[model samples]
Target chain A: MTSLPATTERRLGLVIDLDTCVGCHACAVNCKEWNSGAQDSPLSDVDAYGADPSGAWLNRIHTFEVTPEGAPAQIVHFPKSCLHCDDAPCVTVCPTGASHKRSEDGIVLVTEDMCIGCGLCAWACPYGAREMDPVENVMKKCTLCVDRIYSETLAEEDRIPACVRTCPSSARHFGDFNDPTSNVSVLVAARGGIDLMPEMGTKPVNKYLPPRPKTNAATRTDPARPAAACQPDTPRPEGFLGWLDAALDRLG
Target chain B: MHPAISVIFFTVASGAGFGLIFLLGLGFPVGGGAGRAFAVSLAGGGLAVAGLIASTFHLGHPERAWRALSQWRSSWLSREGIAAIATLGLFGIYALVWMWSGSRLQILGLLVSLGAAATVFTTAMIYAQLRTVPQWKTRLTPAVYLSFALASGWLLASALGNHAAPGPWGIALVILAWAMKWAWWVRAGRTRLADSGSSPETATGLGFIGKVRLLERPHSGENYLTREMVHVIGRKHARKLRGLALALGAVLPVAILIITALTNAPAPVNLLAALSMLAGLLAERWLFFAEAEHAVSLYYGNR
Candidate 1:
């Protein structure tokens, strides 16, 4: 049924560190690469070399300007995917009973055969976690790598989700949130990880550790210049105007 | 909130169709005496089926649409499908019985009427339940839907049933429907992410620091999220469209109906009113989709 499970034996999800994600799309790419062949290859890309290409992707990264109070703004690389909320609106809104949450692990998955591709589930999701594949005509979303996480054939190191395994900076951590001693739960407690939209009442399983504060601006002292590059110079005759005049005279 | 033509036609056409059915199922006198009973039933039933069919056009797998009926336990969309089918089925029996016997079944007619109303309510809930759209997630959404359905239902029945002008009650319904729509638009203007205690800050969980803004989006090219959710109509164009919709859908039809009611104008004037109203309502439905700013668009900094 599309109805969500009231409780699961384990809440398995990811903890993303906004402090370290570097805007690298390797997670997104490895995710596409592995999951493309995971479940009948629902994720699709259109017109790779063509002029206008549009398709579905399960994961993507965004960069944001986070300005701390009374401090300079910082750029944070944000990697976004399905948070697999305890109150998953996308699952309940599915008309076909194709979208459902597992009672065992609380991992949300779609039954591809039962999907009608109406796209209502996508609309219900506030996180843009679900994507409707233009080619296969099915709603594609993060399965939390349900196949890989419990696979027996793969090596022990390969048991984790492809995205978590491949992140260079270890920005993404996967573990069971139901266990207090798990790495994800420990990190959440240690770094004060937070939910994306708590006001939505979705009760997202995944949490994000905010970027650490950098109080002062960078002051690079290059040997050639031997000056603090962070200092702002006053606009006088000896400043930008003088340089502009010299450059204009050289052009003339 | 891209206003796909297929879904727009589905909602508008089906709303009007079910509205007409609502009137007929109330034991109206039209289907009793004359041979126009089949025509009336066809008008209502045919449009409902047509709209339902049109809805499938925008679906990725129209062939799999039959499976949508399975999840009525939780989904409003499924409930709508079930209600629509049940109403039409009961209506089929009721219309056929009346056509053969020429005597109205009051009890069955009442059932059909209730079914029609319930079906329309479910349709409204499909949009109203979306918290992802704060503009639509309100009581006003369903209220406007019911009012418009009632108004359009009366107009269609007036024009198509007896070729006569609708009475004072119908005219009042027209006024009420447009008034409700006007109120909805006013409220919609004030509905923002902040109203739901959601903003760029809450969306990022970075509000305690300061205001958060999107520096770079996830994709340089258009993805499904950007294409489907970020449809934005300019404020000036939206204002113009609203005016055009009100004038045509509301003012013209109400004016024509009133003039015909007072004077012995030609019966075809009702037809003109119906056409004008349909065109106007189409524009209104288009605006309904075009103006909806999805919450996901906040992540992309589009809204």
Candidate 2:
């Protein structure tokens, strides 16, 4: 059962836009809120009101400072979770039939009932996607909101991952990547979305849209002028200007 | 990666046990007069079983461990579980037949010995197959494991043997294991593959645009992933431990083993050598996990 299926009928995944993410923790918070009450593997927290609080969360957002050669440094907000890789190592490494990828939708999931919680699946995942819940004593990861997406009780428009639905900047997109006309696929094609750590050969289903290139006007700004130029070295003028200059000098 | 004590104990103890069983299967029954062979067998089997049980103690659900044996088709861990169980079963049968019939069942003994070897190999593969820890994904991982196992087995056999003089084979195996371990350290230290492949740029798919560094972590507190994977050992401490491992595990054992063989020392000397080697191997095993950098650690700037 650990062996992966030869193929899936549809590859459902997420596409995130780095250009628009605002580094807010809404998606992660919503993920915690929804999955905490999920039908399977409900998330739990330890030391919630104590000195060191920690909990299980399916999604996390990170902030990074990128300094390119010959380019100005930029801050990028990065949200990360399980990519539900086509060739997920976590699935293959599970000793029990706990970690498995669905052949129907290509979504990797952990069967809590079967899991031994040996932590091998977590070790095999290079992306740190899996977390062992201390309370349940089972491995937990992003389920791609399987419950919400397939729920007949929910409205059609609300049938999406909690993270995607709660993203304030609309940075997260969800759809079937196998469908060429899917919104995620179109976005991937338009923005040149890339896979994270392709060398790992996980064949991650999620694609990340790179930050958009800086505008010409921003890039073309003169670098030679010193910012101190706003305060002129010329002697104060004789009238109101002189008085203003004296006030500014006193403040400085 | 954090070097869990239970795991280190499991690998070392089981490796020696399987190695002892392998030697016994090869028809090298302890030469010491009466009941020595039975005692040795008991010791080996006890060590193996105890190590296995200890391994389950760290699992979140030890009672569900039986399920681990069901996924051998793709999981090295499953293969290991199967192999260990098979090896133990065959060893038990071989022991019973030897006790009742007073004859070594050559074919069954051989099969059991091969199963022991297979168990050790599967154990090695559990770490070697992991792409997440590049340092462990190497041919040397298994080589070091097998050689060390065989070497420890020989040392234990020499100690338990009735003969006054130590065998040359024990010393030779010790040297071989040491050399292999040395080669592994050199390769692991020199190879760029051991370096972290996942960077901020790769994690965010922003390398094409600029150099990337972590400005802030996702949460204020450590999560399970960080607690389990993002281990950081200081360079100075690592170097000191490496020297200690080499000296205690390889150098001292080889030297003591050579002295014992040359002087035709008593069985106690052989026992001393075996104990020293086990101590060294324990340290080596600890370092093996402590030094391995998981790719997930890149996100935490631990890499």
Candidate 3:
């Protein structure tokens, strides 16, 4: 049997790598799939695949076009969800002790039995991480797939959350964040990471990797295919809209 | 800060309730010829009680309302509840003094009524003190609630004025209340979004020294926003509603009351403005909740 401490660790967390992330949303999809099938409570969809399609998703990705003060524009895709903070405002504000942070593992979880569905937690959280499952009438979020992570039936490599395991680029990592030597800790140290909205002081455990810097030299030429070796499928337009002319020539 | 209907009814009912008592304690004569100032005070007092009962719906455990008074040290809800009870007690004493002493007790009743009104001001302060919620954090919150109460109270007085005796006091208080409402709207408009980085870097307590991007969410199920922020509303709609509230709550009522007070317009006009003020206050309360962003929304990168 998995020890209770290991089953629920105080240092539970995730480490995302921005450099390798393709923003394919596999993590979000797999997470939806696994959570909807969980025993504790399954996320539901009301009028799903219809006009009023709505369902629970612990994680969501947002795309932003960042034009740094003096730099050229760059596309930054962000996948947002809960940070399971040490001082979760959602937990503290809950009138009933429904919302709580695990002492053994830093995971913030809610007990369905105690939740009154008042939604005070939703207002207290700054990250917009907490969501109410209408069907169950309780709050739900990323559990780090607690049921599967330490299951003996699962293979050691597959013991991680469905989101981490399904990631094609190995961009997602999970471990004991308290240990300085853990893989996530090493990755965070080597490639600096940042937390969202530090001023609120929720003290979230998850770390986000910063987007890689794109230099002028890197953008001036195509690294994947040499410019000289590239064959034009179509004649190029000169000056304005040259790319559009080249594409037309290729089509012709 | 979604406005719960229970609270809306509570504030409005209690506000009008206290305002009526404040006016009657001064022994202002009504020209309406009903000659029942004492009865009007009792009715208004009853409304205040009704409003308090409605407010209980906002609590998780209505049965434990007594326990709420224990935490006045830190909880505004507790403070508001205590003030509410005190206001009721003062109103009760004012009524007893009025029945027994008549003009001789008027001074004492006026003092108690003012104290009761002060309690109502403290009740408004309860929601205004939550610095974490920027929308309620404004100094205008107390002024807005108090003015709203006075405006509603004055309007109620005017309705009963015709039955007892007509006077400029009702119309004057109505005009003053509307002025305060307009000032609150102007100040509320000036507040700007102060915090950003609903991103992980800011929310997770990580340093600001480096760039931060979300790679994977900690979980996969929908949690709170899908339920709360899901109340869809656009900036255009919010702006339009604000204009409507200001016109109805402030400009219209003020205009009507001034016309009646100055030109001696028919009783119907004053009566119309009083009813309009009640409806306008409700809309204003709704906007207060809808426009105000909760601190929790910061996590969703909404900032």
Candidate 4:
């Protein structure tokens, strides 16, 4: 069993660099793999490898077409998941002692055995991080892979979370948020990052590095034309082939 | 703010139970049949308990119900539970007083019963005050809850009045409650929808300037929407259901009660009105829950 880190005033967390992120969804996939077989497997699916596949994942990618108010640009991909907020709404809303935020690490966690799966925590959460496990009939969410990050048996460099460890693009960083000198804290201070839906007042611990200034100067596309462009204006050719062409052209 | 069915039923049932007991308590000194008061109280109490039991079904761990009463400071549910228990206790005490003595403790019973019913009224306001859900936020909710209880309570009292009191008094209370319910329905129908934090325009802090389309949802599948707001009815179907609830719950029952009252109808006719009102109230309660749209639905790209 992995022993949790020693007592601390405030627990550390992640600062994801959205500018560096390629919207790969690798973090989400690996997180599912790690949590599914871990001590308290956090990931769950309603119907997997079938029609209407659905489940809970700690990390999720949301693509948002962010055209800055007055600027001409392309759509920006926005991936959102748990920020593991310092003032988590999920923790306060839990009727049972199921959802909690640890003072030691600032990590929001759900105790499986205690969870009644009332779906209250999910409602409380604005980010939609928590999910219900149909088989276990309890709530599940990101622990930030607490087991691997704190285990003394692991190498010093390998003590980071699975998502941070596996991030190929080096977009995610994990360290002590309490320490001002910490790498994650420094990067946040230097580069102006933003929290998703900050107006919701969650005070999310994780900081998303804002989308970089648009680089493609030549390729400026109108934001509204994508839906309109999907329709074809030209008529078809002839008989059977013409009908097939019309169907094919319509899908363009 | 997913309003559990148990809680909804509990509020409606207990409200009616206490309302009936209060009105009966008002005219207790005029000594009549012992069985009459007992039957009305039992009917009212049965409906109230039925609602309480229905709410327990919504609990994640129904076995841990006892623990719910402990969190009185923070949880409205806890306060509701305590208030409900107090209501039941008062009802029991009143029942015993009516059985053991004549009209000795009638005033005290009336005071306690009215106090308990007022507490249930506060419980209804708890949901109504939630600005997050525009449907519940309306002042009409408390009025509707109060009217429904009064209507049901009087309807039951009318049944008991067949043997106990003069026919006109019971019919008058029923008519008053019936009118109150119709007025409530009209006000609630005119109530406007509140803006919940569901839209991307609201979520992103961006005004409704540019057309903001959902490129992707954060998760793959149903997290809470498929669970809480899973109930879906088409616009036509919803319209039909609303019409049915209004006709049966408010209009039809009121019409039946008025006809009975005006015609000096028999006991069975009055009983039929009570039964019809009960049936309509159940359908009305169902619509109240189903029709409520949570602001959270906006995050799922629902307008």
List per-candidate RMSD values in Å.
7.3, 4.8, 9.6, 10.4
lDDT score, residue B166, model 4?
Answer: 33
Residue A174's lDDT within candidate 4 is 85
In terms of lDDT, model 3 sits at 0.65
* Per-residue lDDT of model 1, residues A1-252, tens digit only: 988888999999999999889888999999999888878765788996799877787888988898777678888889999999999999999999999999999999988888888899999999999999888888999998988989999999999999999999999999999999999999999999999988778899999999876646456444666557656886457688899978987998
DockQ of 4: 0.16
Q: Write the per-residue lDDT of candidate 3 for residues A1-252, one digit (tens) a residue.
A: 000122334488898876677778898898889889874778866666555556767877655444545555555556666777766766655545556677787777777666656565666666667677767766777787887887999889889988889989888888888888998889889888666666667666888887666667545866677776476666545776887777876999
**Residues B1-303, model 1: lDDT tens digits:** 888888888888888889889988996557235367888889889888999999999888889889999999899999999999999999999999988888779999999999999988899999999999888898888888888888888877886665333757667988999888889988888886557677888888888778799999877788988878877753338878888899899999888888878897755467677778778888898888888888898799976
lDDT over C-alpha atoms for residue B14 of model 4: 71
The count of residue-pair clashes in candidate 1 stands at 0
TM-score comparison, 2 vs 3, better candidate: 2
Superposed on the true interface residues, model 1 gives a C-alpha RMSD in angstroms of 0.9
Ranking by DockQ: 2, 1, 4, 3
Query: Against the true structure, what is model 2's DockQ?
Result: 0.71
Candidates in order, TM-scores: namely 0.92, 0.92, 0.68, 0.75
Residue A193, model 3, lDDT = 67
Q: Can you tell me the CAPRI class of model 4?
A: incorrect
**Worst lDDT window (10 residues) for model 2 chain B?**
B191-200
Best candidate (score: DockQ): 2
Supply DockQ values for each candidate: 0.64, 0.71, 0.12, 0.16
| Model 4: lDDT of residue A105 | 80
Error of 1 at B249 (Å): 0.8
Candidate 3 — which residues are off by over 4 angstroms?
A1-11, A69-72, A102-104, A144-162, A215-223, A227-252, B1-11, B14-133, B154-180, B194-247, B251-274, B293-303
Per-residue CA lDDT of candidate 3, range B47-109, in tens? 788888887776544664565454454445545667668767766776665556553256666
